[model samples]
Target chain A: MEKMLAEKPVNVNEEGYLLEFAQWDKDIANAIAVEEKVELRDDHWKAIEWIQSEFKKDSPLSIRGIKNSGALNIKEFYELFPGGPLKKASKIAGIPKPKSCI
Target chain B: MKNLIILGAGTSGTMMANHLVSKLPKQEWNITIVDQYKTHYYQPGFLFLPFDIYKEQDVKKEGKKFIPKGVNYIQKKIEKILPKENKVQLENETIPYDLLIVATGSKIAPQETEGMNGPNWHKNIFDFYTYEGSLALRNKLRDWKGGKLVIHITEMPIKCPVAPLEFAFLADTYFRKKGMRDKVDITYVTPLSGAFTKPKATAALHYLLEEKGIKEVIDFNIDRVDYENNKIIDYADTEVEYDLLVTTPTNMGDDLIKRSEMGDQLNFIPTNKATLQSLENENIFVIGDASNIPASKAGSVAHFEAEILTENIQNYIKGKELKEEFDGHANCFIETGNGKALLIDFNYEQEPVQGSFPFAAIGPLSLLKESKLNHMGKLAFRWIYWNMLIKGIPIPFVTAKMTKKGKQITI
Candidate 1:
């Protein structure tokens, strides 16, 4: 957490915009492990890491990938936070407010 | 009696309406103006609206207030035009005239982009070009806790090209005032190679952009908005995600021009280089954004055109030889925020040369130099636009022709 926060342009909260996708989404998705209900097993972290690796050059994560990471389906994952991952992740990670921002 | 019909009540049309009312013999010609909107906006103020420099009410007034008496103002949407028949078809009635003037200004048509006007419009993605968009952005900014705010321009040929830059500067100031400047990251995205159309202005503005710590992303040809993924992707595979996206959509001429036989591919009327008369049909004339002139599409250009065209129209009506006169002069006050601004004056033949305006070397506000005096001068223009410009009163010290006396001739 200290290392991610220490890195330049890593905090989406600081820039208010997401310059890189892997850093921005993963910033939020990685923090999901800290949440009380979330149990980010190696498989879940692997899935997010996979999405980041493929998408570092501009590939974005798909909803189907959540299942590949051994997490629930997209709907069940969204059911974790009423605000949903896109909105919650974006706000927490400091990605500029996407269309889904409440 | 010869009928003169103007197909808009915007800044240009209203100015022309007042000028013609004063110049033409009311006994000889009846002037009729058509437009759908009842409220007249100080369009220059739209740039200030999002930044809280100007409120919606501050820049708005009833359209009929500035309209001179004896000129009939009809609030109606124009459907089509038959230039060959010298007639305009509006929703309520068909206006037939001896002289027709098309002054309907251009507008942002995001629908031209495949995914531009999708579900994310005005919600996640906002445009500050219109009154509603600016007002909505004001609201969005108020509630914003602070984060990556992207000020993006879809394409150029937009009215007041410097407005987006002004927005970035003002946003920096606004967020700072709100104690969120530390958290806010402002990035300016443009398709242009520089911050401005001119090299000099870009160099000067680049310093300001750098001083403000605003990230600059140049030559971004945006392909589409992936709303599901929350990112704006370019053709070259560069994706910039944002918390909020402020975009200026593609500006195009009015639909009526397309309906008429006189307009170009983008629905802009093809007018003579010097004369504002329609190239396809001489009886018809177009000014302001609707006209496809090499001149910058601006209110100042329209004001200059109105002055020159009035004389041309009078000469044409008298069967006298038309003059190859108008030189495409356009001037603008670029707001640089912190109560300071810069002024740019140029014409068709000359680029925006670095020099003071009007008085030249001895200026209260420096030319091509940013200062508080220019900001105050810009603030004062609102009063001038309402009292003098729209009323057709000739602005002293200004003319249709570009004067080289005060300007530094560029290479």
Candidate 2:
């Protein structure tokens, strides 16, 4: 669905992840971050940047991937984003949430 | 005759051997399959094994019984695969291959988590992903005065993803049958956001958790097992205490992938998801849980992949363009206790929705809804698995690629 983010129409899914990465921008991210109750700081952006880069490469994101990325340890990752870090950070970075075949 | 070697005589490797043995011209290709073990385990039976729903004899048979007469079967440890050399290193012999199929599947690595395989291993802490683990759990449950029964998943990409949930369901049934339903506190814990990976499934099946009184602990990225305290501590410092901990530990591709330096961080080989051809080399193909495909690591997925892979291998041999036809198709029966189960039919593009299967509005087997017929199908599957599935026989009405005929995708 198209919704106004940073005063611009951005397409997102029901869960608020961006449908197209092209529609993602810094202002839009900050807007979504506000909705997710996450304040975008340097530490948060580091993880978000790493996540978006991985998504662009079509690499499936997982907690395991984050642990191995060398950008941050898992403990600091949880602290940076709080609660469900991977899903929250991916939303802030405008990538699809990680999923497994059920 | 050129040699076509298959590593691992498990489901995928054995099916490949059966598939190509008749298709590959006898005068042109010699097929040989290798595995260190003699037993071909009915892996799905591991779920029922703990509840004593299945016996050891029912789940295992001689691996040789399944391999066709023409193919050579070697029971020996595989040392490594020298992929660049197009050769495989066995314990004492190095065999060159015109084509190599890697089916060395995934297994549980309890040691991947600290304190998982520590002092209390197999005593109270258990895994049912293996025959040993299942049998050990069976013995443990035989006399187990139930406490907090924690059914956990240490990480994702584990084989038979639904088995853990089924374990929770069956545990409820088992305890009820034993007249000790209240004696056990069943908790389903996962690293995923909910009881299921897909949103629709989570929505469709959330009632099972509520109906059976199974507590859920989601988004739990476990850091270590506090074995001394009988607690699993996550990165967030959240702890879930358990008396009887049934955990599926970190599942990884075989260490041979690591030794050969041919796999990703999880040791799964990178492969073309559609063609089943290894991305790194054209002559190499991977199937089953060994490849890092975004599909459930289950026998059903392997069965579907075997059909597409057989065609692809023949295409590669015939110098034809490979068909990008594998659509990440996976069909599985989710046992939801009380002589009922749910059947889910899905592919890369389709989420399992409410409908009939293999026929539109005429399903003897309903999709995404719990039914007793589906439960019967689950029981009858053991026979099909042993008699037909591993023999490369096409299951009636099931296709290599999923069909959208009977599905209600509008939801």
Candidate 3:
């Protein structure tokens, strides 16, 4: 699906997660963060940057991964993104939702 | 003769030994498998063990019974793998290998969580991922007056991902059979978003949670278990109290991976998802829960990978291009209790769907939907696991790759 983010057309999934990392930018992330009702503060960007880098490296993201990441503690991670932090953070960072083999 | 050393004589290693013993020329290649333990456990039975559906004796046997006559089986601890040198360091001696297969599978590390392994360990808090834990939980469940029965998963990538859910379903059945269904308030907690992660599976199976009266606590990334308070505190500070906590703790690969400096943060080896070969070395192959592949760490996945790894090993020995043939296929029976089970056949690409299995329209077992025949298949799997699966015998009508013929993929 195509959606307007940051006043530019971008590819996103049904849940509004950006499909292409190349299409992601700070403005688009800010735009998605607003949609998720999360205000992008400095700490939030720290997590977003760390998670985006991990995503680029193809590391499976999880709360445990975040705890070991040194970017933020899990409590701060929850505080920054609130409910389902990984899902919202990945969306804001423009990565696919972390999945388990089901 | 060249040497082939397989670590961890569990499901994958034993299957590899059986498969390669016939395939590799005796004069050319010598095979040896090592594990410190003598007993080869039927691990899937651990799920049923707590409910008294299976006795302790039913799930274990001598490990030597499964290895073929031609292969050499060693009962000794493996210290580390010197992969660059193409050698393995055992407890007392160093052994060299032309090829190495690491099947040193994952296990529960309850110590990873704060207060998990503290005073409440195995008393109120329990894990059913091991023989000892299962037996302890069985004894606990036998006499316990139930209150809040929590079946929790601390993290993902746990072996047999559905076992906790199965535990909850069987608990419902068990309590009902014991005439104590009304007393036990069962809760299924997970770090995942829901009971089932895939689309079709969630759609088909979500009702079971409500139907069985099992409450769900989703997106629960547990920070610590406050044993004194009798509640699990998540990162968000959300607390779920329980009287009896059956948790699948942080499942990590063998510490030998850490000692060898060959694994990721979780100690699972990085491997080619399709080929099952270690990304770092061509000669080292990883299978089962040891590899950090995106496949579920289940015996069924190992069984499928063993088939592909056998072919790849043969290819590598002949100095040919490796076959990227493993499709992350897994076939599992999900016991839904009440004399019914759900048989799901899926791969890295496909989510389990509703349809007949093995046959296009005519199945002895149905997929996704519950059936008595599927339950029978679940019971019969124990015999198959011992007699055929570990012995490298191809199961009748079941292939290594996931078949899309009978499945209703679209709907």
What are the per-model DockQ values?
0.01, 0.55, 0.49
| Predictions in order: lDDT | 0.73, 0.91, 0.91
Q: lDDT per residue, candidate 2, B1-411, as tens digits?
A: 899999999999999999999899999999999999999999999999999999999999999999998999988899899988999999999999999999999999999899999999998999999999999999999988889999999887789888999999999999999999999999988887778757677778888899999999988889999999999988888899999999999999999999999998889999888999998988999999999988889999999999999999999999999999999899999899999999998887787888998799999899989999999999999999999999998899999999989898873
Which tens-of-lDDT digit does each residue in B203-262 have in candidate 1?
A: 555688888889988656466777676677764567888888888887779887777655
TM-scores, one per candidate: 0.78, 0.97, 0.96
TM-score of chain B of 3: 0.99
On TM-score, the candidate that comes out on top is 2
- lDDT score of residue B39 within candidate 1: 97
Q: Residue B355 CA error for candidate 3 (Å)?
A: 2.0
In terms of lDDT, the poorest run of 10 residues in model 2 chain A is A54-63
* Fnat of each prediction, in sequence: 0.00, 0.41, 0.31
Those runs of model 3 whose alpha carbons end farther than 4 Å from true positions after fitting are: A1-28, A56-58
Q: What share of the true interface contacts does candidate 3 keep?
A: 0.31
Give the 10-residue window scoring lowest on summed lDDT in candidate 1 chain B. Answer: B191-200
Model 1 Cα shift for residue A78 (angstroms): 39
Docking class of 2: medium
Looking at model 2, residue B154 earns an lDDT score of: 87
Between 1 and 3, whose DockQ is larger? 3
DockQ score of candidate 3?
0.49
